[model samples]
Target: MVFRSPYPDVELPDVPLHELLFSDLGERADRVALVDGRTGASLTYGRLAGAVDRLAAALAERGVGKGDVVGILSPNTPYYAVAFHGILRAGATATTVNALYTADEIADQLSDAGAKMLFTVSALLPTAAPGAAGAGVTDVVVLDRADGYPDLAGLLGSTGPVPEVAIDPAEDVAVLPYSSGTTGRAKGVMLTHRNLVANIVQCAPLLEIGPDTRILAVLPFFHIYGMQVLMNNGLRVGATVVTMPRFDLPEFLRVMQDHRTDRVYIAPPLAVALAKHPLVDQYDLSGVRTVFSGAAPLDVDLAAAVARRLGCRVSQGYGMTEMSPVSHAIPDGRDDIPVGTVGVIAPNVECRFVDPATGEDVGVGERGELWCRGPNVMKGYLNNPDATAATLDAEGWLRTGDVAVIDDRGLVTIVDRVKELIKYKGYQVPPAELEALLLTHPGIADAAVVGVRDEEGEEVPKAFVVGQPGGSLDAEAVMAFVAERVAPHKKVRVVEFIDAIPKSAAGKILRKDLRAREAR
Candidate 1:
């Protein structure tokens, strides 16, 4: 695993996971490590290192050890990354929980992962505390809180440096990012230290990150996209990261102007802001040299329009959570690629498209399921061998469940998802979960949820419900009911009361029929 220098033949260090942050760049101890958006707080590399060490010591004192699952439910703040890296430094696995998830949703994830300790923000403590307790969580620590939970600042200041714990980079799971794949309930994706570290190294060349690079960190760290591209890559290259707690278009543009952001890694909806939003004219965007969009497909016209307006290069990438969230990355200054293509396979990654019906490789320029074999692929689904076997083949090629076309130029265009998961603003929503929840409603006899493109051209969940015999149910009431139970992103935007839900002979919901009906 040595990267040989082409010019001077220099040998890189083969350090373990914990050593990556401490070793990589020289003279970086004095650089700014993270900038907090909420209170304009910042921590230099030296201060951040001290905090991580102390937090590691505190967790160790609490009997947290290697392979232990530590759940983190917070937004995009400085404490999020500090706690995340600290968990890894303590030789424990970090399981990221969506802060907006309902108590029952959070509880299901915590119980499934067997998380022993939870780290969350004070504002979200009400939801997470009870959820953690319900899942048998023993210890709860709140960040920036004065009471109710252990204070993060006090723990960091009081504890001493922790002794290094032995870790197997290949075998020890480092992150647990939940995804619903193509069907069923959400399952934790087991990402080992090697899986993540390899992805960092693989994406470094494409990102072209350097000490002078300044990235706008607005994406949620709980997701794999931000975890790899923004946090991990920024630290490795000694770049300045300007954080945002949430996405506000005007504030995002203001931060770019204030910080002179050189590069922005954004989702497709953000691209819409750059393309059609009127407020974009108020801010100066000359500082941004490149904009990379991922997590969902970027509309070709919108991407080009954004590039024209900002006078900067814009590109789209494609990947899944199972692939460490990055499989293909289009280089920044290249508009020569065919429209709608997500560019080529990243360095050290092998991609092959196979026919879905028959397990045979498709010819170049053909459409099929995209399969990836690389170190960036997850080790497997946590505690779900059935899913692991279905996802990863014996030869180790991970089935992406995404339909794509690979052209002669090596560029890949993702056409559709074979899986039943829906992407609402880059967050995955499993229809099966919603369907199961809908059945719990007394008035609902049966339900089938499907994704339909809204006026903005973004996927929104639309549920078709069958009322119980002689039961009175309306679309607005059903929609409102689900809205209150789930996170805002998972809410059913459109609902229709139907006499019956169309299903196959085997009892699988016919989502295609629903999508076709919406198209009409």
Candidate 2:
């Protein structure tokens, strides 16, 4: 059962990403490229291109090119785009770090990726500085002005020509955004220039975004969904992209109202808020023509309710960090497809439903693990062959580890998860990471972490602990212990003290048994 995309394949360009995105800019030189939602500042197409060229030249002057791995640790901003494209334009790999990561978490990623230089803002220097130092990197450029660090204004002051460097789009790695695939710690996903270019081209026909389109980019650009879909796609199509530094519901609504942005991209958590929040009624969201949710599953009823209230087309998509973030999406004109299902596969994609128990292909309407192969798939996990081999096969089919059922018409509905990675508010929270952190506490003798539904029906990490003899650690203490060490989204939400943790003969924590216990 090798299902294929129903749409015509898009012709992928062989040029570098910068060339694909920056060409023919003179025609729309004065048109707005990006808008700073908070400060109302903007960058016109001409100015953005000029700045990118200057930054690229400056980075090259610093001897960063070709095999160099540079890091960007900043929130969503117009300058974030400049720093990102500048890194790629200089013939270096850009690894975007999560803005909310702690210093140690930041250091771990920078060290693992072997990032030679880091670009950040003054706000994040508190973490970025230490992280870079810990990774033995000395060059850290702050995107915004700081007393002692190089700033974007200084970096882009160069009017010198960017050094000429040869690039093979198909073979050159462009960006490395880390992902916890199936089940493990974060590993860098090696997305080459061609992989990204192909994804943007593949999605264009389905999205129908254009020069007149205005997109609200409240989603962080570090994530693939925002990086490629919202930012890069909008730039390539000559659309106006408005950047938001962080997600504050009132501010988000205000920006949407102010910009009259027609296109909105969000995750499932925001969908819930848009459907049920009281603040949504105060703003005029009438200009929003399309609302596309991805990064996690969306509830059918919630999607319908939001559409009814906002008078917009609402849809959801299926993707992962490894698949250039999109394999299927409910196309804009497919009004008949249910919002709960990720509509037909993208152009140039082939999928399969494999029975995990028997390693056999499953037909339509049968639940099995979803596997997909496409031009947009990553080359492999960086420097981790074991993980790459486990996730991607010789035939190029990526084991998505998601239980899915496809209808005869090719709509995909993600029913359950075959992998252990938990999606907490659309963020991947690995149980193994939490379990390892829990084992470090002296008061905890044994621990197992699993995903449990909260009162609002969102998946949250819950820790089942076996306390040491005469230990005084309580639920709040345990929760606070991990909260201080991890990102806000990865914090433990619930804690339960148990006498013993069930395990298999090989001493593996039986997560299924714990899930069954929670069900009971």
Among all candidates shown, the one with the greatest lDDT? 2
C-alpha TM-score for every candidate? 0.79, 0.83
Model 2 C-alpha lDDT per residue in residues 1-520, reported as the tens digit of each score: 9998889888899988999999678676888999999998999988998888899999998989999999999999998999999899999999989898888988999999999999999999999999999998899998888999988898888877897879899889999999832245779999999999999999987898988999999988988888999999999989999999988999999999999999999876577568766789999999999999887666687678789999999998889889898899999888999997999899999999999889999999998899999999999999999989999999999999888889999898886567776898888787756775776676876778899999999999999998877889999999999999999998999999999886521133667778888899
The list of candidate 2 runs beyond 4 A from truth reads: 180-182, 420-520
* Model 1 lDDT tens row, 357-442: 78788877787788888777999998899989998999898888877777767788886666767899998787756775676676
Model 2 clashing-pair count? 0
Error of 1 at 172 (Å): 0.6
Model 2 pairs in collision:
none
Candidate 2 overall lDDT versus native: 0.88
**Clash pairs (backbone) in predicted model 1:** none
Clashes of each: 0, 0
RMSD of 1: 10.7
